[model samples]
Target: MVDNRYTILVSNEQFRFTRDQLESDPGNYFATYFFGEFAEASQGAKELVVEKDVHLFRLIQAHLRGYDIFPLPDAAIPPYMTKEVAIKNLHRDAQFYCLGKLEEKIKELELMSPNGRTGVRRDSPSAKRYKFGDETWSGLEWMFQDLNNDGYQLMLGKLKNLDMAIPSEQPLIPGFSLTFCWAKEHRYYVLLASDD
Candidate 1:
């Protein structure tokens, strides 16, 4: 008999877990969708493909195995997994998966300022102008003549340092035509032209 275990392909990595382990919790989307009685049965070893970050998926898998998502005691996390990139990736994946509890935990981590405070600094002029609240920021709508490459880079750096989460959806900036450039190392920037 073909083993009933399933293989999940995430990004370039393949993860194997038994049908039982996957179905152990009814709350898991994979379990509910793949292992439910109305779901199609697999003839042999089943392969499911997921378009997600593999490293993040591993953390999600660990959560499925009854582990709490981050702020896990430092001892519980592998040294290589302690970086900000890993946490950001995991948070993005959790949001994609609609794992509400895990998403909340990751948001808490994201909101922590460098000094261990719960909020970001609101002192800078840019910070005062752009940052709306804990998460949202005002979209930029400066006239073309008002912003230059150096100024844009400085603004981006400020945002990065503040750990601001820029919204992926760019709403049309009134009276400004926007252009995006993907420079070396895949860095993205938006340039504006005055519609006036």
Candidate 2:
């Protein structure tokens, strides 16, 4: 991961980025200043100092590094911030960096925000027992087929974006496991798990 790193001082705090990482996006603000036909590029400066919020810059750098969503939003941002304030700060930095489409992606992530307003994630180590221990071999296609045969429905429309936004290979749905539970409303909650 270390490839001749460069230091960036943001709001009196130091952050580092490798050469390829600085130039990862050809059109991004920092990438242009470091590699484009600019005066800074001529000097080959090893460090950059910018006056910006450190927390916001962290989110921007994560975005530049191909990370779209934080697995847990609360832990990613400053602890003192409210969810709305954090989202606002993230949006501000995203626009300031001229991050194309990141604004929309951030909004998409905000929709799935698990901040106790609508839902939240609880880490139950015993929930590990639901780790697909007894299930026989079957792929997503076959699993969905079996669910349908059992009058269980796989809600594709709701899960599509959440799956892409989350880092896990297993999809994030109503419940967080690879087991199917019967709902009183005649609905099936099928949670998928992977050997992580």
Candidate 3:
């Protein structure tokens, strides 16, 4: 009997996907790569060698097998104790794989400040937690622009202890303190006074 299972060799390790399973997501690159008009198909190859991070590839495999959202790193993974790097990497991978749903889900995750909770955003409105990094500043730039147009709310509420005083650190965007700050984690100062 002919085995309908196909092999995906990642770093010399093996993973399997059935023809039926792959055909289901014909739009995905894996399916196209394995089954499209190519040398592998003509040669009747049953396995395709893949070159990618094994952990990430496993996540992609799980996604193809119907995993909606991959979990962020739970513990301190070097250079990424924060959830930022993990999600960003996954989002990059999702885009490469053309997985729209996974990419969108990653984007919908909360933009947590250093002093904020990193729950799924449905858990709590996190304004204070710990470890404000470049990620948080990047997030704040556009997320609370309406409320922190003058950097008042951002200073008083979110970054109170960080010492991000207005004007000195605030952008000269007139009415908007528009800037992507690189200062977080280390001590800094910031506060805002409203025009009202």
Candidate 4:
């Protein structure tokens, strides 16, 4: 007998949940899409693939398990994540999944801060918006000129060299690691390195 369970794959992670748990709320996107009689998932499909951040998918699962995603408690924040990063990731996932209510809730949370600021500001600049294109280089120029002109020129040269060898569709260079971090003197740094 086939078990009444379904596997949801997000990024490189797999999550299994009972049919009942996913169908508990009939109006929910997951429930409606997976359990409705005429739905594709209801035709004995055993697995669904979701191309989203695994961490955000875990939070979405928690929401399905009767946990509210908004108004996140301080205790729920992961050790390596700041609350702003957590909310931003959740918001992106919610938006991608067409979870309007969840997106609204996240937006609400984003607009308010514990200290009454407009929103949570990170000490480091967000590199999520960066892409592999001329526009990205332009944006980097604007950002880096304010930090270190020499470093910006070196970085641009490196990026141009990489661009020549790698296709635009391939954002990740084989051996290089890219990271954003805060630096001394109130500057933000984009660090890139290759194994060589």
Q: Point to the candidate with the largest TM-score.
A: 2
lDDT of 3 by residue, 1-196 (tens): 9988888898888989887666654466667777877677777778888676666666667666775543455542334324666666767877887776666565544322321233323234432222221223333342222221222333345543444333243433333333223355542322212222
Q: List the residue pairs that clash in candidate 1.
A: none
Give a tens-digit lDDT track for model 1, residues 1-196: 9777777888869887776667544455566446644344433327778897665677777776667666555544445776665776676766665566677666555443232232434453333122111112333432222333334444465554333233464435565554332222333344444453
Whole-model Cα lDDT of every candidate shown, in order: 0.52, 0.54, 0.52, 0.53
- Model 4 CA lDDT for position 73: 71
User: TM-score for all predictions?
Assistant: 0.43, 0.52, 0.48, 0.46
Off by over 4 Å in 1: 23-26, 37-45, 68-82, 108-119, 122-196
Q: lDDT at 185 for candidate 4? A: 36
For residue 100, what is the lDDT in candidate 4? 64
Encode model 2's per-residue lDDT on 143-196: one tens digit a residue. Answer: 331122111122344443433221223334334355432222322334343222
Superposed by TM-score, candidate 3 places the C-alpha of residue 101 at a distance from the truth, in angstroms, of 3.4
Off by over 4 Å in 4: 24-28, 37-39, 69-82, 111-196
Alpha-carbon shift of residue 100 in model 4 (angstroms): 4.2
lDDT of 4 by residue, 11-65 (tens): 8698888877675444555665677654675586777887866766777787666
Could you tell me the lDDT of residue 7 within candidate 4?
Answer: 83
